[model samples]
Target: MAIPPDIKDSIAKVKPLSQSAVRLMSIMADPDHTVAQIAAVVESDPILTGNVLRVVNSPAFGLRAKISTVARAVSYTGGNMVVGLALHLCASGIFNNPLDGYESQRGSLWRHCLFTAIASREIARFSDGKADPEVAYTAGLLHDIGKAVMSAPLGDSARKIIAIADKGEMPDFVAGEAKAVGTDHPEVGEAIAIHWSLPGPLREVIRHHHAPSKAKEEYRTLVYAVHLGDFIAMMSGTGTGADTMLYLLDHDYRNFVDISAAELEKVILDAGQEYQQVVESMFGSEEEMQ
Candidate 1:
């Protein structure tokens, strides 16, 4: 289906991922890049550096000594983690708005993304998959970026799609979205990711998090990680939106990862508490009262 002209125009105006973020991902992709080189690139952007430090020092990592510098953070979290956190920090502002049809509040979507990211790391740890926990985390954080893109101008259409899905018991929200808006958020998100030249795996995860069975082998694990993480967060009521429970678990997802319903419950319970603490630390005294 062709993208509607209005939606296409809005999407055309949306900014690509920041250059600093692109540079960081490039450095991460290069095996020869050293810690100092990565640090140098990150340090060039003061805002990005500050946000990265905030995340590393937040309750999530729980480091003993306060990390005050980019190099120290890179040393502590490793290059991949540093890059992941950088991407997270850079993209945090993108999903801070409410999608028209979704119940995600201002910043609520971001919180959901954050929770999914944290849960993804836990899933990775348990499955012992080749997936980098940090990469999984970043993928989880960005899985819903397309919703943000679609909602900017197509908010009304998106809202109608969600309403139909909710009222008619549609099997898939994406189908409802396609019926209402000519495209699903995942496809739109993939387009946006492609425009930004995101890492291939990260792009695949964003495109396929909602449908992990369709992803390539290497990407399927990460996709499932984010998918499971999203479900766990929604079920736990961590930072869920309107469409939180609109989707069902893919049967194939069960075969890709070793997580059980019991284990998932435990992760959600634990991550919920950690999520609140992290949000409190990140926002300082303004943590959403739930």
Candidate 2:
């Protein structure tokens, strides 16, 4: 679908997806790249190298790695881990702050998105291996691309539209967004995903995360995973904003993914254990919040 003009203009103002992140994703997607090649890319960029070192020696690793070189970092965690950290560092720019019109403070949207990403990866792990955890992580990270697209145009008016939706006056939250901004976030986000050359399934996750049942058959499980991740983030109070009331739990997911509430609870707790560590490693320390 063509992007709504107002939302497109807003997307225009927002920072484009990082080219370095895009290149890293492309290289990672291909298995032909050797560890040396990946390390060389990180070594050439000081900022990227610093991010790699941070994750390598983070609390998540359970010890002070004290690693000093990009190649050694790559050796410690393998090429795949390096790619993941590089992706995290590169993708942080567009998502590193709270989106105006979508939240009251900076980093709120990013916090919510990170929560969803973490939950999505964990969900994929316990879904009988039906989902790809790596892809799930990427999808969760970018699921709210639409809100970012609307940031500039919607500005502070998100609350007004959200109020209208919360009052049960619209078909759903997306409808409320359409009424206020001339377009909805899901569709706008889908456009951005396609323009970014994301895989078809990832695009579906971005577009149908709020309504997983509407997704195509092949991508339904991935969609459901993101939907649950989104719900978990909302329930956990990560950064729901006005969406707290607008979205509902997707009950139909049980038929596809086999997870009990007890298990789900455990998942959240486990994710919580590493949440701060993961966030600080990817985005930076609490200094980012200030």
Candidate 3:
């Protein structure tokens, strides 16, 4: 479905990512780029560098040695996570705001996205090299960004969409959202990805995260990783809004990610803990999120 002209205009006019954030994404897209190169770009931006260090030092990693340099932090945190952190820092305004349309309070979406990122990374580890864990981490981090853009436009229709999904009148919330709004969050997310000139895999993951089966053949594994990561986040109670667990799960994900129930449980438990530490380091305490 074509995004409505109004939403298209909003996307075109949406806040541009910081130059540092854009640079980090560019470096991430380059397979030949070394971690030091990304570290250099990150160190160029003091805020990004400081945030990376903070996340590394957070209880999430439990590193005994304090990471003083951006390079060490980047190496420890993984390049994908540093890129995700840069994106999160640049998009703070969009993420911090409450999604009234989705009935989500402030900070909930950020937590959900962070949880999904960590979970997606863990899921990718079982992909047998079909998916890159770091790339999956970045894709999962950005999978729901379109929701921030779509929230206001969704407005009161959020309830109607939820009702339809709850009653099984629609296949899932994406269908319900498309029925109520001109487009769903994934579609809007693709538009935002285009606006930001994000790489193809990231854009594909964002656009088809709800239906990994529909993504391009090359990106299906990565998209499925994020799709399952989103499911894990929602199941673990880190959902962004009223539509939590309302999306249909594509069971075919097993074809791509070979994880057992026990592994999935472990991923959820570990990701939930990491998500809390990242949130506390970047935003504030868990109590503040509520």
Candidate 4:
């Protein structure tokens, strides 16, 4: 599966999502945008509106009243959180499809993305980092999108990559991907993010999540959050797919963020419970293996 140089270059030039994602990113950048304005944009896309409301009423928020509209959900959860959560919901279908050799169910990827998004937000809050929780959430959710895309067109190569990864370890898996597919999932995800016209920060986060040290300060934090969140989810036996065996807990990551082992454990524990409730509410099931 030698990757052609042309394909590699083409992938490098890939754009992000269409106008919808770009518009949402623009609104997110505008601090002056009210909840009503943000909700209006989400409402313009009926599917996004419905998903937002579904998330708001889910156990993740624990709202007592049923949220019938995007506006109320945004108002209830605060604009920043709503924006991040909305993006996750809106894009879920795009990444939720089954992949050969991945071992994830129809919506498993979407569930894992949402889990990481929530966990990343909690980590940022606990770290007291200036990082935007919404941005962190979005970065975490889309971190592995490349794997989804690669699985589609390069199914055989993807299987070989996973096979080699399972036989060795995390770095080995990455190496195998580079050897068999010309690039790893992180790079592929970065390419896809760029193809979709996602924000620069997000594109970088997706590119470097597996190697946070390669990113700049802000992007480094985003990558770290996604890395930690994904590690915790994999350990918890939550929708890690065939890639679960490749999971590695990078101890040095805490050196960049100054979080202790005890603190890390707490974040993972709390996130597990939240993950359960959120998954149950969204998919009507708490059993990840089911």
Winning candidate number (lDDT): 3
lDDT value, residue 207 of candidate 4: 81
List pairs with backbone clashes in candidate 3: none
Global Cα lDDT for candidate 4: 0.66
- lDDT of the candidates, in the order given: 0.72, 0.71, 0.86, 0.66
TM-score of each: 0.82, 0.84, 0.92, 0.79
Tens-digit lDDT string for candidate 2 (134-230): 6677678778877766666666776776667667776566776767677778888888777777778779999999889999988888789888988
Evaluated at residue 172, the lDDT of candidate 1 is 72
**Candidate 1 per-residue C-alpha lDDT over 1-290 given as tens digits, one digit per residue, 9 for 90 to 100:** 67677766666766777677788777755546788987888799887788668767877577898999888877765665555456555665566655656655677677777788888878866656566676777677778777877665445564565667767767777777777678777888877777777889878988888888889987787788888888878777754455667787887766767878798778888888767666665555434421
User: Candidate 3 on 23-84: residue-level lDDT in tens?
Assistant: 87777666578988998998889888888888888875778989898888888887777776
TM-score of 3: 0.92
TM accuracy, model 1:
0.82
Kindly report the root-mean-square deviation of model 2 from the true structure over all alpha carbons: 3.2
In angstroms, how far off is 79's CA in candidate 3? 2.6
Q: Summarize candidate 4's per-residue lDDT along 1-290 as a digit string, tens digits.
A: 34456555655644335444557666765546677777777778777677667767877677777888777877875654545445545555456567664655676676677677777777766455655666777677777787765554455664676666666643645566677656677777776776677788888878877677788876676677777777776676665466674755666666656677788788888888866765665555745323
- Model 2, C-alpha of 121: deviation from truth (Å): 0.7
Better of 3 and 4 by TM-score: 3
Global CA lDDT computed for model 2: 0.71
Model 3 scores what on Cα lDDT?
0.86
User: What count of clashes does model 4 give?
Assistant: 11
